[model samples]
Target: MASNRPAPEAPYVPNDPDFGGYDEQTWEEWNPTEESVRPVRGRHRVHKKGGGGLARSSTVLGVGVIAAVGAGGIATAQDGKPPVSISLPDLGAVADSLPEAKSLPGVGALISDDSAGSPADAVTAAAPLTAAGVSSADAEQGTTDAGEALRARIMRQAENQQHQADDAVRTAAEEAAVKKAAEEATAQQKAAEQKAEAKAAAKKKKEEEARKAKAEAERLAKLAKSFAIPTSSYTLTSHFGDAGSMWSSGHHTGLDFAAPTGTPLKAVHTGTVKEAGWAGAYGYRTVLELEDGTEIWYCHQSSMNVSAGQKVSTGDVIGRVGATGNVTGPHLHMEVHTSGGANIDPLAWLQGKGLNP
Candidate 1:
């Protein structure tokens, strides 16, 4: 009975004879055909539906997930929050077929196989940094930038304060100027008022004086009508109160009118002749008394025309001029006496009667 299968070569062993280690056997050579053999379990290669493409895609996806987790850890650490717990589904079978993490392109620097390696360090190494070791975005907002902003704010505030102070100063100056102007205006007004008042008072005083002068002139004009001159063609020689050795008195108490002898003497005003003759040094004198008791004495007369107790009118011939008693030349000595027997200047009395002798 011959079987159509090839015999396997036996291995030589140094053992006892029951295991047939010393037997000499013959092997037959045979080649197997497809029809003669059946497929054995796990002996031949079997092709899957898609190939290794799905596995490669899944590996790339896993790498991207690891990178995303690392980025999240860095962000969390920078934010100063607690570390987040991350759970991943087991992909043991896929991990076993994948290459080592360090051997992968662009991913080798991020993930580490060393147990002591820090995830933070690995993430920091992958991120781009500035000269100060911080990220570019973080460096842009660093302490220097903050300080510059603060300084700018302070400058703005100071400028505003200065402007406010200037405005206040200007306002105060304007107010003071306005007050000064008002005071000056008030002073000017008061001065003008005082000047006007003084002018009015002066004008009133002048007007009152002029009125009084007009009244006095009118009174004198009226009185001139009632008075008359005593004699005409006479020259005034001695006035009242003349000092001489020619009379009994040391001073002459009468006004002397020099004229030729026999020059007629007229009554100065309307009066009654009280006496027509003199007995002593006043030779050929005549005395006339008025209604007001004023007396007129005509002395050194050459002759008398009016008798005693005769009423005589103004301009009536009462006597004639002469040098009869104590006379150096022909002249009339006229004396006036008030009601109280006081002698007065005859010239002044004539002027009071509105007559200039």
Candidate 2:
């Protein structure tokens, strides 16, 4: 069975002490580091002012030693016994070992728990550091630097665009030049081809002319071999169309070749003798008819070698020169008549037969 009883009285502890462990000056001079930890709530609440905690860090460390060593014991007014020997570190030596914490003009360093991720995060979770003054010059400098960067970027872009435009123009010019050169080359090729064609035509025309001339020369040479003159050793006495009363028709109608009697008179061209007997005004005359139906007469002939209906070649003796009837002197009188009975100049007519009179 349990009896209802009041709990025994515990020992007493002074929550607030009269010792001014630290002031605001100590907080200003206190150096913090990455390893620094905020004061815990057990013994560091003695110098707290209002809602803010830990006015001085020295008050925290000073009472924290008592709380730690005397955790198992408590003080009472009725007992006086030697306390447990617990050693505390020297405050002056600990303070001297810390580095000086330099801060901005009106901003102070903040104490934070070690579990905080960063100072900024800790500041957000705790108190923010305040700066005395921010400068307008600094803000303006930031704006100027941004503007300068943007300007440099824009300038680079513009230069790149300009270079691209220049490259395009250069490429266009080169293409045009190439096209023009190609055109010129094509025109030159056509001109060369035309020139060659013209030269070939001229060469062909010359060859044609030369061949015709050679053929004509050969034909003339062959024809000259078969032709002959009427008589040799004869003096020209009369020409055709010479006005004289000695001729029967008032004008001489034949070419006269005077020679000694019995001089041979040959056939001028291949023909057959048609008349071999004497005639009234022209005695001892012979009429030779050629294959082309032309008639040739030899008058004033003393004798005849080719009779009527006899074939005679060029250069055959057809008659002789003598003083016959109706002759001005002993000579051979030759007359050439066309098939149409027209008489012409014998010298010019002979030249038509390819004979130089």
lDDT digits (tens) for residues 1-357 of candidate 2: 211122223423334242233221111112222233233333222233345333356555644444443432433212453343333333343334444222323222344333436665433333223312223343344422445545655787999999999999999999999999999999999999999999999999999999997887677667766766788898888899999888768999988888899999998889999999798778899999999989988998998887899999988998898887987679988899999999977777665565654
Please give each candidate's TM-score: 0.54, 0.44
Score residue 285 of candidate 1 by CA lDDT: 90
Candidate 1, 28-104: lDDT as tens digits = 22233332222221211111113332222334344435544654544443334455443333334444554554433
Cα miss at 137, model 1 (Å)?
24
lDDT of 1: 0.69
Candidate 1 local lDDT, residue 271: 90
Q: Which stretches of model 2 miss by more than 4 angstroms?
A: 1-195, 234-262, 276-285, 299-303, 322-357
On lDDT, the leading prediction is: 1
